[model samples]
Target chain A: MSTDSPIDATRPIALRAVRGFHVGGRPVDLVDLPHRQLATVPGLQPRVSNPNGRYQVGQLYVQQFALAAPTARYPLLMWHGGGMTGATWECTPDGRPGWHDYFMRKGYDTFVSDAVERGRASWAPACLVSEMPEHRTLEQAWDIFRFGPPEGYGAANGKRQAFQGQRFPVHALDQLAKQFVARWTSTGGMALDAYVELIRRVGPCTILAHSEGGRLAQHAALSVPELVKGLILVEPAGAPSTAVEDASRLRGIPHCVLWGDYIPQNSLWTIYRRQVDEWLAAVQHAGAEVTEFDLPAKGIRGNSHLPMMDDNNWLIANLIHEWISGAMEGGMSG
Target chain B: MSTDSPIDATRPIALRAVRGFHVGGRPVDLVDLPHRQLATVPGLQPRVSNPNGRYQVGQLYVQQFALAAPTARYPLLMWHGGGMTGATWECTPDGRPGWHDYFMRKGYDTFVSDAVERGRASWAPACLVSEMPEHRTLEQAWDIFRFGPPEGYGAANGKRQAFQGQRFPVHALDQLAKQFVARWTSTGGMALDAYVELIRRVGPCTILAHSEGGRLAQHAALSVPELVKGLILVEPAGAPSTAVEDASRLRGIPHCVLWGDYIPQNSLWTIYRRQVDEWLAAVQHAGAEVTEFDLPAKGIRGNSHLPMMDDNNWLIANLIHEWISGAMEGGMSG
Candidate 1:
């Protein structure tokens, strides 16, 4: 593995536009609330206010970075996982360019998103939401993100351990932790709706999703199969059950799933991997093109759940880009 | 007035980098807690999770877009007002180019920030925070943002009215509301600390801040007066009292304050405007160059609290840009 950063930080890139917008939420009306004072500043008197009228809730935020000239036929919509935002695709914790920059450099216009109720996609009031938001602790992130074994995160600095050959920058776990956000279990449907709305708005486009976002992308593709040109699932937490979903609908949408180094070691991932494998088999049975990359099997070692943030993230991005080119061409030929 | 959007949205720009990072937060240790299951999917079994460990809290997120060619000597830091993120400077709700796009095209490197506990800057647990978070209702926003009189936002579309000749796209008020996020009363100090840390990291810079953000920029300027080349405050909510802040320290920094229409009609802004006026007066008294633009007085009318998002936002941006050039030259000569 190379110790040097893959990206040159000072290099300039030509861009058509860097813009952002909100999509897919309806107004919810709040009526007849008693007047109250809300304290915004500690020393100042609380302002008397009314909590009434129409408020827009459940909208997703998308920030687009368009290359001057795109080689790919379709734009790429980058969706982040749970407890994370569009920042997942922006830059790695260790300051290297992540998938967004990598793919943009590869001549793809990228739309990175903050799903509904996450990041810049503001949340509704607690009463309107189905459940309270939950936060991810570092211990939980270490165990679940597969940085190391369940007990690898110890009390002291010296006690913390990464899985042998862990490609993730374990020392930068705190930096990754900074991107953790409070997510609600109830907003999955809202997020899926917003993502589908995004696909409709952008017309024909490919979706590259991570973890929780993968399932949302899967559903969005199924919802609007004609608009979704390709689906890239990176370490997805779960996939739609083959028995439940009509796999024939996804026949035109090429699918690619990428797995990192350690799956058998983690009990949770073991279950998730099995579920996805079954789902992919069902999709393939229905005559859809499906590609799977198990990193270790492919001789790419020591990768974590967040391969895009790994030391060899650029390499992984290149692999995905190559796969995308082949898949798009195959779709055209078929 | 021309109905055409002020910005040419299709233009391309050269950028050295479009990157994002987190700054200024300390790790908080979570003590012993019983293991529990977290429900992330509606139909699936909840996953067992550990809630004990170190968590990073109170950090701020900043995204930077650097121009390719040298022009401005210092970068511009854009801080959003309450209930908004860096998205405030990204694009107008009506799909017009925002301050970020305009300023970047004007040959300035721009760093737009999400303040602590807002937007990409995730909030701490309720237990860790001083007070519960609050959401702004459409009625509250209408009253405070001064789109019209307190009674302007009627329940029916036909009944609603914008103060005669309001420039804010009233039909798109819902669009603006989409950018609103839940904010905390207790996180002001944390936000200030993070803003100061950003100043230290970015070196000498001018700050362009809106509403509540204006106060934070003011304090950050006072904390590191030498690093803050200038301050552009748009409808600032509050300012440091002359009796408490040593205005002499601000003598070297040029200050610009801009106000929109209908302040007298909105009681709250009248008080806020007065405080900022006194603060600016005191700074000018202490020998700082101070410039104030009451838009109506300058023949720029029909603007609301968020002048940067108004229909004529580009015109206002150009005004600010010209002022910046003059201030920078004056600083050099003086």
Candidate 2:
């Protein structure tokens, strides 16, 4: 089922610029005197009193990939979902070019970020940071993401009972599984704060938020809708409870919610669907322009929840490109 | 991810038996008084109807592959979805060995049927047939099946937007399109009648049904539960609107409903999900051993609605084999 899809070879090679920065750093003192203990060393040494690393403020990490000869009308900013990092947009488990590269090829200045306390962002002491997410085991992810039978992925030995025609590269299940990280318990507010600050610094840009990142994206949009050129929600974790006033402010920003495969019979997904619906209706009532892409409605089947990592990730990237192009061009179309 | 999955190759090779037969045919009279016309080149060529073919009752066509050394406790009779024939189980659109061969290798005597008015079961005159489905356009199927964008499928030029991670053979989209036939508007009842008769003639057996075939499978089980040893519903289009009484009759049968990928945003599929839910609940309440495989819940992603044709189709087949083996061994288990 392979064909040489048309490639724009003549398109000018992308002139790329890359940089990194930190957001929302705060100061904190290290308490060492309380736990000091004597150590048997050649020289007199305060066992636990010595400072570990330079004491500084905690901040979120941001990586920017700017295309000098950009084709897109607006810069694109991406936020990762829970338990994930900026790597979410970098590459896929199947080793395909991730959304970041795909969009860059299409000539968009792209920025990906690690939320506060995630990835390159230095972790703060438990007291300094807000609620932290518990580490997720491989079993938990396999169950939560519906990878296969409760027995875990054994596709290698054919003990897997994965759905027929499932899109997740069963051959690469373990590779994809390796990407799942620990999710925070209640860092939404802090993440929201950092995201809004990031948006303020970045200026007006189109944002793509996946899963849990959706809450922060919504908060940022609601707080400063003027700076958000567009919002692309990929199977949002949940939407903020919004009033018409909050939503109306987002009228100028075009929004789209894209869902991947498998929602029926799964209670958790059902709830997510309802949340998306409520958000859609709420935003529409406020006169905000919104579009929903029910993949199945368009006869697109077999897309897993994490479409960006699916074998056909490039195809989805194309769809998103079209949507973003249309929205930025003053229309909301698929 | 490419680890060689374990295959029960050492299991005895099946002793196979092949047979063909017709089901539910009836007599029809030829009318000689109809309007007649003469042909210039022939001797009084009459326009009036004459006896056509051999005189036999119209019945569905059944092709059976019986294994002499059957490992499965009961025979497995398969019914294809709407607009399809027994070919649905024969081979995949991508040319891989399909479920029929896979299961036959597992030692299950398999029977595939072309429903009345479909495939080998030649259609009778309108007066003799019950109902016929309307022809579906390529556009309609493309839209309903989510093959790609509204622009339509053109694999030759690579103008397709199949869902990212879709398992469908995009390269074979055109080939698969060529196989789709017209469906009947109200042939469910007639097909059900013939299917029930087939079951009666073949004796008690397990059933594997997809899409529209769900109706006939359900009815056959409900009408004669004794004849249905086990039931495997693969993304059934809809299920029987069975009351507790109707469902209780199926208490002895172990039923499993396996949903493929992507069902959340599809409005049409929402209705289908509801129907499946209703059927599942009713059957469970009736003390029928039932199991629902929500693939997404198990992290088995990227499965299209047609698991049989998916890249991981054999994995799905293995799951069903386990379920059948468990059920036939005197108790229903996953």
Candidate 3:
């Protein structure tokens, strides 16, 4: 179902639609395309997307678009937290203006992508494990490149570790670690030397993450240091933990944190403390400025986890704009 | 099935248990208990009710327990915000020691209740016309003095009001004004002196509200000033169209303003000009001291309408205790 390194023809056609740039504000069609494609609904307005250049790279499929004026040199790729698809960025629950416009007007071309391990991936986990032949469960989701499906769960044999209700036999972290290792192994495990090469190829960008996607952002940052300049995370689920120590060592890259007052702590909350501690230490280690934010309380449909979708989310919009301005401007002084 | 006044005797008994200072440190039994309804799963721990007393007069059905000191005036009420019934206060979502024990040791008696309103009489709407007496449609829940169902809904021939989402065929104010007229007519069209006499019987107490309930609280204040003393609303919602002029002209009582941020034109995000022209003027007219609180943003949930339920909700708890503690402390300095 998947071919490594072979380009998909759809990438160019999508790219053309995005490049057209509706100066007159022509109606752009973001029709919920197949396999996690976004579409424009009647009551819903389209926020942002790049049909072109937005292509699938191996297992990971990404949608990228260039933002309008006041553009930043580094691109911004926004991701949905876990249990949420990229569509979360496209429409309000009741079908209204997506936050995509907020970033675009501010001049950051945004990209929302799917994590390669689940959901719309064409290859099933069963099939995916076949290639590298060592993956199992949500944990093995990370190991396609380095080890086979962790011990017992792997085709004939891969170790299994399941905690909570996770169907995966391995620890989520263990799987993630092995997956990164697999990716490294596939590329000859050159570590930073090759990671820097990929970073340069992917170009410069900052990550805007929510919920579980925050964890992915942390991993991406740790794996590829030079590619990232800053991180704008909103109530990211799993963060900083021990990973924060690694993330902080990346040197002067700024980290902005926005957490909700009533937000329930999960792995994310744990990460918040870890990341902040790591950051404080990281700054001490690297001698960089650290910025942190705590969002005031508000209920979105009586639920407190999803902040961007809060009925009274205008505060966040202002804060985002301010944070971006501070970040873009602060870079000069730093 | 319900009657007016506090029917504590006939109602079932309810107990609130915490992890540290439980009944012999054993779990609580919450069956057929007089006001102690388990809105959540039985095995789950009980949390404190709102300290700010927002979100459905949440404090009304509290289960009070003795503190370690046995002689504390202001007992701490553990409140969990939306979604969570009240278990959130005892332990973090992942189950760890929360604020209850921390405060109990500090010599504060603790109380616990649920913010959920489906079963509470306090949440019943103030003014809806309906044939059937459902929970809070519009009609006063009961003739409180009579301790029986009111004449309108109880009567088989009662006229019903239409429910059109947030819209209504009748304006609440106009309806209230008409009720004033009808109530007057039914009472032989009494004069202003008689009206004042009737309202005085309504008695004294303060109301605190959050989110949508805030609008209702304001309406209650505007309509029945005799029944309220210094309204303490936490982000109440109301239309400026009807409330502005009246609120501005109002006099005597204090209004406390607590909001995170303000964006132009949003009903939630009123401009300063509007605030001065409308709300602040009303507060001045009422002659109330206005205390503005901009709480810390971190760990804040989507429940902004409910500042009293934050993890650090003691912020407002202390504020409330300040007001409540007044007469008890120095016998009215004013």
Go through the candidates in order and give each one's C-alpha lDDT: 0.85, 0.63, 0.35
**After superposition, candidate 1 runs with Cα above 4 Å error:** A1-11, A32-35, A155-159, A330-334, B1-10, B32-35, B155-159, B330-334
Interface RMSD values, listed in order for every candidate: 1.7, 34.3, 29.8
Best TM-score among the predictions, by candidate number: 1
TM-scores of chain A, one for each prediction:
0.94, 0.86, 0.55
Best by DockQ: 1
What is the TM-score of each predicted model, taking all chains together?
A: 0.96, 0.46, 0.32
Which residue runs does candidate 3 get wrong by more than 4 Å? A1-58, A68-70, A119-200, A240-248, A264-285, A297-303, A331-334, B1-334
Provide the TM-score of chain B versus the true chain B for each model in turn.
0.94, 0.86, 0.38
- Model 1: C-alpha RMSD to truth? 2.5
Give the distance in Å from residue B180's predicted Cα in candidate 2 to where it truly belongs: 60
DockQ for each candidate? 0.69, 0.01, 0.01
Distance from true location, Cα of A277 in model 1, Å: 0.6
- Kindly give the number of clashing pairs for every candidate: 0, 35, 71
- Which structure among the candidates has the greatest lDDT? 1
- Candidate 3 displacement at residue A5 in angstroms: 42
The single-chain TM-score for chain B of candidate 1 is: 0.94
